[model samples]
Target: MFLTIIVCGMVVALSAIRANCHQNPSVCLQAACPESWIGFQRKCFYFSDDTKNWTSSQRFCDSQDAALAQVESFQELNFLLRYKGPSDHWIGLSREQGQPWKWINGTEWTRQFPILGAGEYAYLNDKGASSARYYTERKWICSKPDTYVQMVQQSPN
Candidate 1:
């Protein structure tokens, strides 16, 4: 009877330890990004302080393995807005004036929040309004998927 109790206690202790170790599986996940890049959800974002035209900004982001920020959802748009200051920032929405807008990744623009004005490139102003002015120099935000590589533990069979 005493041996049975001892074995059960050891089993419970080991289970508790395992549960604690995996309380937050994300705690074991690691993401790699350049210095100064911000991590949110499963992505990395970089907000540039230097002003540049939309085309140039896109080039810079491409060099960094990212693209101009694409507001895929309201939550993402709000996240970008929260980081925005008093100045306008270039986003990934752009097209020939009077043409259907599209993201840098070639995705069609589907969101309705950023009602862009008649211009070739779109930007988000301090008021969270999205408008277009291709030649205007503005700060920019770049986003890319998280570079996290999960380390898998092998379980003994």
Candidate 2:
């Protein structure tokens, strides 16, 4: 009976440890990002290998509980430009038919970076961000908030 109890307790502990590590790979830090995600500043960014059109890419990100990455800072933009390699990847910018271009988060396009091609959807390549048809298929980057980092930082010290 004692051996059985010990085995059950060990199983529970092991499960808990697996859950923690699986959820966040770097638990020693406040906001550890999951596997395959890049943790930068307070955000987690994921670059996908599969190709999809602008709309499909956003839907894919939504399914992953994230959004197409929004470039808020020059540093973030540079990181993307440098790491994206050769293939062009769809970003979160698109026009609403007759309306002007905007980020996926609903911010107006302020032209922080020059867009090269002409189209309804924007993507990133070695030359920089460009716009192309919405149907143009490409890999994509997704962004989400680091799950636990902010909570610990905001909690009462």
Candidate 3:
């Protein structure tokens, strides 16, 4: 029932943008995200309850066809911080010994959010983000773009 309402709302939204979908295909349609994942904007997020080391946390997300969450802006970070509850959850940020922090996709971390404290792997906590050794066991967040979304092209009569 809840999903039906969401689908109906998405259909209304997609109707407005369907024409432009050919140019910016990613945002075109379909809110049919995976069952357990939460759909926000153009991405789907999963917060795990089970604890694991950073590498193992990432591995679990990989099995779900997603990667550890990456924050692009303050708003996104806040959304994560708010929804992540009290327990800290691993994100996709990490650094090699004495190297720069990078996301799982290998993109270098920017000032989008500050990394407080000291650890090689990053996690979401009350303070937004904090570093911890990769082996530090904790819950994790996984995310992936809403690539399953697609617009069904109409055939001319």
Candidate 4:
């Protein structure tokens, strides 16, 4: 009878450990970001309320371990459009007057959206349309990949 109780207790303890590992953040695997940042499709984004020139905005994002947000698909583009405030916002697209537009991450601009002008930097206008200009001060969005996020192990409460 003692042996039976011992075996049952061992089983219960093992079961509890497994459950804790699965439910506790200390042992679980997940992706996360800093407060106020939004996560989508394995990426984290920050929409800034402060307006800055294109170059300054890009530098700010870089300081946060991210780059200016790059819209790679129509779905993502639409998502930004919907959430963007009334004012135009800076994106990662930029180029010289006659050069091909490129993202800050070194990717060529996708043709998913029409370029409204031959400006140096691209932004979403107040009407939810994309336009390019060099010196406009606008709010900006920053994005970082999941791999850049720090994985923390939390102690179970």
Candidate 5:
């Protein structure tokens, strides 16, 4: 009985430590899925190896229990940009037609648009950031897993 009590106390303490250590929110998702992904502001993100159209990329992210990243804040956007790979990857936002950008999931664009570099947008010069279409083959960013998130496995009896 004493040993069991000690183990229980230890478990609670350990869990508390884990939660406190990741309060920054930026690293919350990372704590859940470390392999092939990183966490930022309560979301996990993963870059794809294969390039696809905007619609197709959204579908791919859906299949993987994630969605295309939604840049909700400048800090989050900067985080994405800093960690984003060298290759011009597609993001979930685009002008589609006129001025306002849209998210692939139909969420209203709440985040400020990242300043585009020359020739950077959509299909025109994906190597850079200028056009606004889905046909472009630039690499893209996707969110972290939203369901069945893997957790720290407990020891077997």
Candidate 6:
């Protein structure tokens, strides 16, 4: 009888430990960003303090250990929009030199929130367009930071 009780207690303790460890990887542990950026989709994205060209903004994301955000859905697009400040910023998508729109991740377009004109790929802040071909710069989203996961066991008793 005593042996059965010990085993049952062990099972309950193990279950609790497992539950705590199985946390969502995308959820950030820290409240404030280590940099000026914010966390989204398990990555940190920054709006530049200075207005940088498309190339420079990409470099900034790279230096911070995150790729530029690829907009795949309206939910993802809206997630970025909520965090946007007054000034517009660049995201990862752009038109090829020949004017073909493509995601920086190289994935074929699966979903598009606001499809642009043939020559239009990059996004801008302002909702209204003077022409169908151009858009104002808008807010950007990024993936979570990469970190090693280590499980620390705690004593329940």
**Among these predicted structures, which one has the highest lDDT?**
3
TM-score winner, 3 or 4: 3
- Quote model 5's TM-score: 0.59
| RMSD in angstroms between candidate 1 and the native structure over all alpha carbons | 10.2
Error of 1 at 28 (Å): 8.7
Candidate 6 lDDT tens digits, 28-66: 353435556666554455655665556666666777766
Q: Which regions of candidate 6 fall more than 4 Å away from where they truly are?
A: 1-33, 97-99, 117-121, 128-157
lDDT of each: 0.72, 0.78, 0.79, 0.71, 0.57, 0.50
RMSD of each: 10.2, 10.9, 8.1, 10.7, 9.8, 9.7
A best-first ranking of the candidates according to their lDDT comes to: 3, 2, 1, 4, 5, 6
Worst 10 residues of 5 by lDDT: 148-157
My TM-score estimates for the predictions, one after another, are 0.72, 0.74, 0.75, 0.71, 0.59, 0.56
lDDT of 3 by residue, 1-157 (tens): 2121133134334443444566666554545577777877667899897999999999999998899999987878988998899999999999987999999999999868788877899999988888989888999999986643323223111
- Cα lDDT tens digits, model 1, 67-155, are 99888778878888888777789989888656788889898888668574667788888667567676788999999866531111221
What is the descending TM-score order?
3, 2, 1, 4, 5, 6
Whole-model lDDT, candidate 3?
A: 0.79
